[model samples]
Target: MRVIKLTIYEIIFIIVCITINLFKNGMGLERLLLPLIIIILFGNLFCKSNLEIKKNREFIYAFILVFFLYMSIQGYYDYTNVSKNNYSLFKALLIQLPITMTVFAAYIFGIKIKNFNWRISLTSLLLVLLVWLSIEILPIIRYVRLNSITDLIKLIIINIPIKIYYPSLVEEVIFRGLCFSGLLAIGLSEDKSNIIQAIVFGLIHILNYEQFSINIILLIVPQIYIGYLIGKIYINTKSLTPCIILHALLDSI
Candidate 1:
């Protein structure tokens, strides 16, 4: 019964994703198919999450739930907030208060990055190149277009401090670095975990599109894959440094 429930829940999520995909009518089915591929892979490989995360389950759930609440609220504001007195930025920051609070609380509560500086440096350099090179060479990759790649870079560099910083970094750290990896540590494969994470990432933007825009599949599939890549970096490196740096670099591109 538990397995059936989980499977049914996942099926509904995928159907919604597909509904958004077909309705958008812009991108190819290829993008839509990617997540299905991931789901199958996940069922085969990572369905049984590791028992270890159970040890720290309380901290993980608390941290993730808090981040979820903050992001979910801000995501809504990003869609519905109307500005008159130039207070949107301030209001936006106010919405983001949870991220700062969580990181500090997590620290005080004994969640520390094990190797600190060394981990940060190595991940930073590698992610800078990993994401940078991928975007730079996209023309030859047969997957992403050059302009799209450039737009990604521009978003990271230009958008971060000016329009969206804490949201991207804090959310990605929690979702990709924390939720995604924690899932993988037990039962989810890298690919399975990535798309699931990315779908949530993409959903945060769903309403921002005009009611008719269906290009969401393109957005969602890449996000999930990207989440997976960042998760892989953190898991292998045992730190979030590379994932954060690569994410910043990738989104910037």
Candidate 2:
């Protein structure tokens, strides 16, 4: 693995990018640009040599194309939200169907699947359940006391697509697949990669920040902390499927 570190110039560039991201709400395109720049710069840091590339032509091509597609769809979604023209949850999910389908297609056609470790996945599932219960158990009890089983089932069915597409697949592909993997490829250790990506995951929620307050800190902490768990799971499993399911389950409950 090629380990690359930021030079002074690259650090300065990142600082500038962050400054631009701060104005992302006021200038919508800046949000998109910052992520693209990040992916390109960091991704290229540990890219393979020409011989390696030639040997893995198919894999490299697919990976690059899919990464770009993921970035584009995510950028558009961010743009819509920032511009205050975001679709309803249901409609937004409907819009994501095509993009999600494309991503799955790329995975199927471009990548090879190896042995998946179900044990690691199960551990991830347990962690997800624990996390969910910690946050939502009280509300869930209230809901159960007030609602019938049929009503609960209906609610779950209705939210399934949204939960799967948003928090599970799309978000995982972007953060764990793109950001975390890119960091690892650039020679970061697993722990460092997880932490960096988790922090970035948390910072993205700043877009939803209403004001500087204790509540904002609380909101960001959970997102970042959960992101760290998800990243660690992805690294352990070397597969996104488990994390996707786990994330959807967490969000649904």
The top-ranked prediction according to lDDT is 2
102-221 per-residue lDDT for model 1 (tens digits): 544445435544312224444245444644454434433443443465665555566546323565556655676556655665576555665566666656555455463445545554
Off by over 4 Å in 1: 1-55, 82-118, 122-124, 136-164, 185-191, 210-219
Each model's lDDT comes to 0.49, 0.55
Cand. 1 TM to true fold: 0.54
- Model 2: pairs clashing at backbone N, Cα or C within 3 Å: none
For every model shown, what is its TM-score relative to the native structure?
0.54, 0.54
